[model samples]
Target: MVRRAGHLFAFLVVASTANAQMPPPTVGVIQLEAQAVPRSLVEPGRAMASAEVDIRPRVAGVVTEILYQAGRPVEAGDVLFRIEPSTYEADVRAAEADLAAARAAVKEAEAAVVRSERLLGTGTSQSTLDTARSTLEQARATLQSAEVARDLAQIDLERTSITSPITGIPGFAAVSVGDLVAANQADALATVTQLDPIDVEIWAPSARVLSLIEDISLDRVELAESITATLTLETGRAFEARGSMVATSQSVSETTGSRAARFRFENPRHILLPGMFVRADIVLGTANAILVPQSATEREPDGELTAWVVAEGRAVLRSLQEIGTHAHGWIVTEGVAAGELLAVDGLASLTPGLEVRTVPVELDEYGVVHDLRDAVAAGNVEAE
Candidate 1:
């Protein structure tokens, strides 16, 4: 037992000596710097048609026919449904007869007045002439009333053929043939939504909106030139066409603390549909921002995101408040500052206060780094 203990002690001493003689681990690091990063406001939004019209019956009657196929494109003045026109036609005929009778009555009253004037102070008394003139006036008023009625009847007859008011694609018909629909029904017979040049509704935070207004007031950024948007569909695929800013809400919402913004995109093929969910990338302008490679960041067990950086020839852990991704790297809003040497490789042996040998590295456009020792020098990355 004593001999075994002595051997174990010798083994421990040899291991300690070997470890102490080993050199510090070599780590690859790139110096972080503030660059003019194109800033963007990203938000989830919904696609909506620029124009949507609900087709409702203008006159009450039984639906005689559904003129349009469900979910088909239609043009303005295209008949979508046909209400039974029998009643409206009958009313029009009746109004026409009334108008003709009124005209005949007006003619008869005028002739009577002329005859009475010819007989004035003779067989016809003054009282008779006065009565004839009053009758003529009444007949003229009746004629005007009849004309109005005829016009109203004609309008009703025309409305029996319910046509689309706008050029758009129609949704499914709410009412089938032979269904009785009331005039100006609460439920629409069909809904037509204009597809081309759709509107993308954006909801951005109120604080960001204020900041934008401030920037514009200071003449720091021209929104008309700098603002542009892109859409990413729910499937994670990017939309091919770009979008332009339309307008912003006059006031922010008190409940949500966000303002509504709209963008217009030309959807010539009707690829984007109404009510579709999308992510809008609204680029405001470019600003200087500190960026670090995502490879250098690590999440601690306590849920804090951290990155290892070189300070005074030793590894230092920095708590990072990440904003978002930019240029294939993380845009950090807090913690690590500009010109900090952040370790990109050899992190397995990294510990706080541990001495580290750093090889200066350079990142490409994709945030991919190459050691300065093995590749052509892009820029001198010195430790801060």
Candidate 2:
């Protein structure tokens, strides 16, 4: 055993001789900005516009002219299509003529009735007076029939020129020029939707719903009349808009186990549209938290988050407990102390107790590093 210890000491001496020839380690570093953060789950939502309507013709007619272009904006009562008005106009005129003729007959019958009554009092035949009375009643009935016909014909004429009932942007037209459209056509000529003000519908869990209720009931918070939400588009970045919580579904969805919450957004620019898939980030929870750069943490092969900060020129890897995430970094809960020197730049190539060279960085009003400064400021950091 003594001989084995002697050999081990000899090997250690040989290793120390070889280690003395190693060069000093140096690495580039970026200063980390720390701030309050909250750990939250991301929820997805959809874009919705309120003004969606199906345009249907009340009266059937051949399409004579299409006044509005497909996919254009129109005002309420704007002429969209023109049907053959000749038939309806002729009917209206015919009904008017009948009404006038009926009125003339009524006047003639009334005069005869008056004469018959006077003659009866002066000894005219009873049968002659009875015939005059019957003729007057028939004329009055004829006038009533003509009046009903005129009203019906006028309504038909007005319906021949189809106008938009709501003010909005119209979708593709179902019927083009010369396409014969029938009354009670299920397909719409076009769809008009209001987009200046839009709605976003999001599905939230019951727990979040409870929190929202608490905030509202306590009077410590007011529902945001204008909160920013992003819309996912088929092309380009998600559309950004400020919206207010407008409504909530009366009951939770049985299948989804979630509640539907809707917010209204003003989109005067008219960029938003209905049926767009979106993900909205609501700023919530307590703001104060310890934040660090995501890069400073080294993810283990097993996927555990680990961070290495320089402690007295030695790389000290710490297993940290994290809470929330912001644009610049993460909010850590444990395994770190305020004002500790953290290795932000060379975390990838570090192990515990490894020697390192660090350069402190300067930061502006925002936690962004600028020039060399020793002091680290503690403030609220926001996602850029």
Which candidate has the highest TM-score of all? 1
Candidate 1 off by > 4 Å: 1-37, 110-133, 215-222, 251-255, 288-326, 329-361, 375-384
10 residues in a row with least lDDT, candidate 2: 375-384
**lDDT for model 2, on a 0 to 1 scale?**
0.72
What TM-score would every model get versus the actual structure?
A: 0.70, 0.60
lDDT by residue (tens digit), candidate 2, 25-61: 6443443344545433346778787667788888888
> What is the per-residue lDDT of model 1 for residues 1-384, given as tens digits with 9 covering 90 to 100?
999999999999999999999988888888788776666778989999999999999999999999888777889999999999999999999999999999999999999999999999989999999999999999999999999999999999999999999888999989899999999979999899998889999999988777767755754444456478999999999998999888878988899999988999999888899999999998887555677788778878998889999988899998986545665677676788887788998889998999988887777777677777644344444432
> In terms of lDDT, which candidate is strongest?
1
RMSD of each: 5.5, 7.9
Candidate 2, residue 154: the lDDT equals 100
